[model samples]
Target: MSTAAAPAPPGDPALLTGAGARALFRAGLDTDTVGWAAASAQANLIAVPRADAYDLLLFAQRNPQACPLLDVTDAGSPATALAAGADLRTDLPAYRIWRDGEVVEEVADATPYWRSDMVAFLIGCSLTFETALLEAGVPVRHLEEGVIDPMYVTDRPTRGAGALSGPLVVSMRPVPAHQVAEAVRITDRYPDVHGAPVHVGDPAGLGIADLGRPDFGDAVTVGGDVPVFWACGVTTQAVVAASRLELAITHVPGRMFITDVPHTAYRR
Candidate 1:
C-alpha cells in the first residue's frame, strides 16, 4: 500500500493514559479524523494475546536498533507489568491493520487484528534521548522550534536478520559543539532504548552529505555550534518497508507508547 500523508489534528492532552489514548484513537480511527502518524504517535496500546506479544517482541529482537525491546507481560494477559495497566484492545487511538504483508485497512482497535497467534512488542524510542539532550542543556532545535525531528536514510547499513535488515536511519539533532560529548555520555546509559549516538561530527563520515533534508521526520536549523547525527528508533520503518512482512505494528515517529517506568530505570 502507498504511504498516505496523515493529517495533523489537535490532540486532546487529557488522553495520556494507555486506556484514555486508546479510546480516543479508536474513535478517531472509526471516524477517520486523525492522521495515521498522529493516531499512532499519541495512542497508548496494550497487547492482550500471548501470541501477539510474542510476535511483537520477536520482531523487535530481529531489529534491535529500530525496535529495542522494552517490556512484556505474562502470556494471554492484557496489562503489561511495567508500562501501564490499560487494556490492549481498547486503549490505542488507532491501528493500521495488515494481512500477509498488505495494508488492508486502518482500524481503531487491534482486537480485530488480534488472533491467538499475535504478540505485543514495546519498542524503544528516540524521545528518551531527546529528553536527555534537553536536560543537559543541549539545543534540540526541532523541539525548541516546535517542529518534528529530521530523520534520514543514510547510505550506512545496519545488522540484519531473517525478516529484518535495512539502511541505517539517523535522527538529526543540532547539538552545540560544546555539549556533543556530554550528550553522548548522558544518552549512552540507556542502552535498552537506543543509547549513545552511532555517529558524531560529520554527516559525510556516515555517508550523509546533506543536513537540510531527512528521510522521515521534519528538518530543523543546524547552526555552526550544532553538530548532527544520532541513532534512531524510526529505522524500524525502513526494515519494515524492506522486509515487507505480511503484518507489523509500530509507534509512529515522535509519538510513542509512553511507559509508566520512570526515566531513572532507563539510566540503569
Candidate 2:
C-alpha cells in the first residue's frame, strides 16, 4: 500500500482566508503565500533566544524599511496578536533552522527545534502588497509565474543594532514602465509592509549584476517591464546569519505567516 500526502488543490489562493491558509500549512501544505488572502497581511518570521530579542527589536527600529515590525510574541510563547490561535511553530508553510550563521535544516514543522527561551518576531512582508499591485493594473511577474519573488542582497548596509547588522535585502518585481508610478503609489500606503520602491531602473545601482540570479527565491522573467525594488524583511535573516547567533529560526524565504489583520488596517 502506498501512503503519500495529498497535494494542495488548484484554485485562486487569494480566495483563502488568513486562518484558512494557516490551517492548510499546519496540515502540511508547504508553499509560498504570494497572492494568498489578498485582503489580509503577511509577515516574515524570525525567532531568537530571549537574550537576543532586544537586539532584534532595536535592529527593526533602526531599519524600518527593511524590517518593519508587526507583532512580537513573548518569550516561550507561540501565540501572536496578529493571528488568533495560530501556532508559530506549525502555522507557517516552512521554517529554516539556523545554527552559527548557517542554515542547518529546513522543515515543515519547527516544533522539535523550538525552545522555551525563544522570542518570535513577525516582520511585515512585501507580498502583502502584491494584491494591491494587481488591482491597480501593475503586473507582479512572480505571481503570474507561480513562483516566489526574487530577493537580492544590495550594496546598501543597514544601521547596526546591538550585535545584529547586515546589508539591506530587497525583493524585485517587474512592473510595466508606464505603471511604475502607480505601483509605487499603491504600495507606499502600506508602510508596515516594506512600502514603496527603494530603487528602480538599473539593478547595478544596487550592485546587483544579474537579474537572472538572486540571493534568495526564484528568478522570474523581467521582459519589457522595468525592475522595481522594495526593501524586504528577509533582511532579518541576513542579520541573523551575519551576527553568527548560536541558534535562530526563520520562515523559509517567500513562505510567510498569513496574519488575520486586513491589508486595509495598514494602508494609510
Candidate 3:
C-alpha cells in the first residue's frame, strides 16, 4: 500500500481526531505535517527477520524510557494493532530508510522497503500530552508557530539494552513560570507517554548550552517562560545512529505513528 504526496490535506486539523488524522497521513501529507500526535518523533522499529525479534524486544524492554513499546506489528505486516486499517508503511508522512546506521533515503511512503521479516513498534509519544497541556491552559508554542518541538541530545545516557544505547534525547517547551507546576502535575499522569519534566527551568542542567539551537526539530521563542524538558522518543534515533545496524527503518525524527490509543489510556 502507498500514499501520494499532496500539497496539503483538506479541511481543518481542529476537526480531525483519531482515524481522521490517520486518514490525512495515509493520503500522503508532506514530511512536515507533524500534527497527529501534536509532535510525533522517531520510533523503535525493526525490519530484521523474526529470528532477531527477540533481541529487539529485549532492547525495547531494557530501555523503556527511550523506546517505550506501544504496539508491535506482526511479522511482515505494516498494519499495527494500535490503529485499525492503519498501514504503517504509508500512514506516517515520512520515513527514514536506514542501512548500517545511516539514513539512505527519506520518503513519504515506505512500501518499497516493506519486508516480511519486519516488525514495527509504536512507542508512546510525549506529543500526546500536548492536547492535555493545551486544555489545561498551557500553550504549545511550536503548534502556535506551526513547527516541530525543539529536541536536544543531553549529557544524560540512556540505559543500554542489547545493542541499543545512546545519550538521552529531550524535547523542550517554554512553559510560563506559574504553569510549570501544573504542566508537571498534568503530564505526571501519563507515564506511558514520557510523563513529566525530566528537568525544568535550566537547559544548562541537561548540558544543553543554547536553547536557540537544538540537535533535532525546530526551535521556538522561549520569551518569558521557563524551559521545561521531557524525555523524548527521538532518543531511539540516537541509538540507531550509534549502533549502525546493517539495515533498519524508522519514522524520521519528528514523524511518528499516530495510534488509535488515547493519551489518557496511559494515565497512571
Candidate 4:
C-alpha cells in the first residue's frame, strides 16, 4: 500500500463502483467519500469490544433513525457482509481510534489498533442517499462546492441502552426552497439510510446556534436554500465519547466504507 496521500481517482466519482473506491483507499487515498461511488451504498463503521457490542446494538435498535444497522461482523473478524473480499481495517479512507471517550488518533489503516475481540458494526450512512437526491434534481451543496458535508450535535437526547447514550447527531444539506418537498420525498424512500430530514428550516430548533460552525466535517454556505437535517451515523462517535468506552474504532467523519450493495436495495 502507498504511504503517500493520493487524490481521488481521476474520473466521475458518481460512476465508480464500491470495490473500485475501496481499492483507492486501500492504496492510500485519504479523503471524504461524499460523491464517490454515488450509485453504491456507503456505511459508517463502529467496531467495539465484544463485551460492549450488545449495548451498542441495543442503542442502534432503540434509535434506528440515527443508527440504522446494515451489517454486524462476528467477533474478531475484519470482513463484512456488505462488501465481499474487503478488509475493514484498510478499505475506508480513514479511521479514528478512541480511548476513554477521547479521539487519540486518526490513521489511514486501523490494523495496528484492531483487537481480537472487536465486533464491527456497519451502520447505514446518509451519503448513501445522495445519489437519489441528485437524480431527483435536488442539489447537494457540499458536493457542488467540493467540500465535506457538515454534521452537528443536537440538544435532543437519544434513547439509552445499557451503557450507551448520547445526543442526536445530524448532517445538514441546503436544499432549494422550491425543491425541499422533492428532496424529502426522494430521501424518505431510503429509510435504512436516514430516510428523511429530522429537522428543517431554523437550525435553532435543533439547538444549533451557528450554521458556520459544525461539530464535525466542513460547514458550507446555505444561501437561499433551506437547511435540512438528517439523522447522522456519526452519533456513534458521540456515544463512544459520552459512554467513555475503553476503546472504540470508527470511520473518520465524512469518510465511509463503500459497500457493494446498490443504493436502491435500501429504498422503501
Candidate 5:
C-alpha cells in the first residue's frame, strides 16, 4: 500500500507578479498536482465550446459575486486578454474535465481536450485579496500551512440563469477576532472579487456542520479565530455539476490562472 505524497509548499505570494507566476506555472513548477498556487495571485478559468460558452457567460453575469468574469478567450483559443503570452492549456496546476456534469478526469494539460470551438473564461477569485490581507498584517492561514483554503457550499441560493443555478459556495479563512473589521474593510474595496464576507463567526448558520471538514480544499485550524466566508468561484463548479453538461473544463479548485493584472488593480 502506498500513501499519497504531501503537496510541496505553495510559492510565496509576495514574490511573484501575475505574469511572472503564469510564466512559472507554464514552465512546470507545481504544474502537475492539485494544489494551491498563490493566495493573492489566483484567478479561475473554465472552458466550454462556442455553442455552450454563452450559457456560462450568462451564468457568470447572473451571479457576479460567485462567478465574476475577468476575461473571455476567443473561440478555440488558449490566450486571454488578461494575460498576454499565457497558455490556458497548461498554466493551471490541475484541470478537471467534465462530462454530463460529472468529472470524468483530472489532468495537468488541457491541450488534449482542446476543441476547435472551445472558449475559455477567466473568473475573479477571492485569492485576489490575498496580498492585501498579508500586507495589512492579517495572516493568510492557507499560505502559512502550505495548503488550499477551506471552501463550503452554503445554504444560500444564487439567482438562476438559464439552466445554471446552485447554492452559493464560499472560501473560508480564520481571522483574529480584533482584525476582522480591518479584513472586511480591505476586501470590501474589491467588489469584483467576491467583495466582503457573506457570513462570519458561526459555521452552523451557513449550514456548515464541521469546521474541520470542508466541501473543497484542505481545512485549516480555526483555533481562537473566527471563520470568515467569501463568495467563491467554485460556485460555478456546483452549477456545472447540477446542469450535467456534456463537456466542460475547469481549473482544479485553488489551482488558479494567474493573470497579468497586478493585485493592486483591485484596490480602491
Candidate 6:
C-alpha cells in the first residue's frame, strides 16, 4: 500500500516547459496513484495540452463507470493537473478508440486521439474495494492466483445521465462466510467510486447465472462461501454501448486509467 513517488520524464519544449512540472509537483503533494505515474511518464514524451486533457476528461465523464474523473489538466495549457501530475497523451500504456460504441483501434499513444474539445476523466475501480477485503483477511482469489477479477453483467441498472445508461457490470470476489460483514464495513467508507456491495450470495439474484464464465475478466473458484459483487467502473461502458453514441472510448476491462490521487480521495 506504500510506494515511492515515480519521477516524471521531461516534456517537449514547444508544448510543455518546466512550469508544468512545478504544477504537477504541487498536485502530487495532495494525491498520488498509478494512473498519475503513467500521466507523468507521458508528459516527458509529448505535450499534453489542456486540449488533450479536455478530450480525455470528456471521454471519461461520458463513460464514468469505465472512466472515473480523477484529475484534469488546464483547458488551454498542459501544465497543471487538477488531480495528478501525469500527462494524459503519453502516460497510458494503451488507448482504445471507439466509433459509435465499437472500438475501432488500439494504440500506445493517444496523441492522435487528441482534440481541443476533449477532456479527461478518471473512474473508480474495484481495487479500493479489494484492498478493504484484503485488510479484513478475506482472500481475493483473483489477485492470489495472479489473474484479473471476474466481471459479469447483471440485471441491475445504474442511474443514467447524458448518453450513458445500461445494465450494471460487477466485479466478483469470494468472501469467507465469517468475514463478509468485515468486508462491508471497511469498504463502506468510500463511495465516490462504487462503494459497498451491490449484491451478495447467489449470483442469480443479479441475473448472473454462471460463475465459471464471466462476461469480462477471468473466472476463479468459489468455495462453499458466499460470492460477493461490487459495482464496477466498466458499468459506464455498458451504458455507452446501449446509448449507441457516434463516438465513445473506454479502458479495456481490467486495464484501467490510473491516477495520482490516492484511493482514499473517494471517501469524500
Query: Each prediction's Cα RMSD?
Result: 6.3, 1.6, 3.0, 1.6, 4.1, 9.4
**TM-score of every candidate:** 0.73, 0.96, 0.89, 0.96, 0.90, 0.70
Off by over 4 Å in 6: 1-83, 265-268
Give lDDT tens digits, candidate 1, residues 77-164.
5465554555555445445554444446655455656665445555566665555566678777876676667888888776765455
Which parts of model 5 are misplaced by more than 4 Å?
A: 1-14, 31-40
Query: Can you write out model 2's per-residue Cα lDDT over 5-39, one digit (the tens) per residue?
Result: 84584488788889998988988899888788888
Q: Candidates ranked by lDDT, best first?
A: 4, 2, 5, 3, 1, 6
Off by over 4 Å in 2: 1-7
CA lDDT scores, all candidates in order: 0.58, 0.92, 0.76, 0.93, 0.81, 0.57
Better structure of 3 and 5 per lDDT: 5
- Off-target runs (Cα >4 Å) in candidate 3 are 1-7, 31-33, 37-52
Off by over 4 Å in 4: 1-8
- Which residue pairs collide in model 3, if any? none
Better of 2 and 3 by TM-score: 2
Number of clashing residue pairs, candidate 4 = 0
Residue 65, model 3: Cα distance from true site in angstroms: 2.5
**Candidate 2: deviation at residue 194, Å?**
0.5
Error of 4 at 40 (Å): 0.6
Better of 2 and 4 by lDDT: 4
By lDDT, the better pick of 1 and 5 is 5
Q: Give candidate 5's TM-score.
A: 0.90
Q: What is the C-alpha local distance difference test score of candidate 1? A: 0.58
Higher-lDDT candidate among 4 and 6?
Answer: 4
TM-score, prediction 1: 0.73
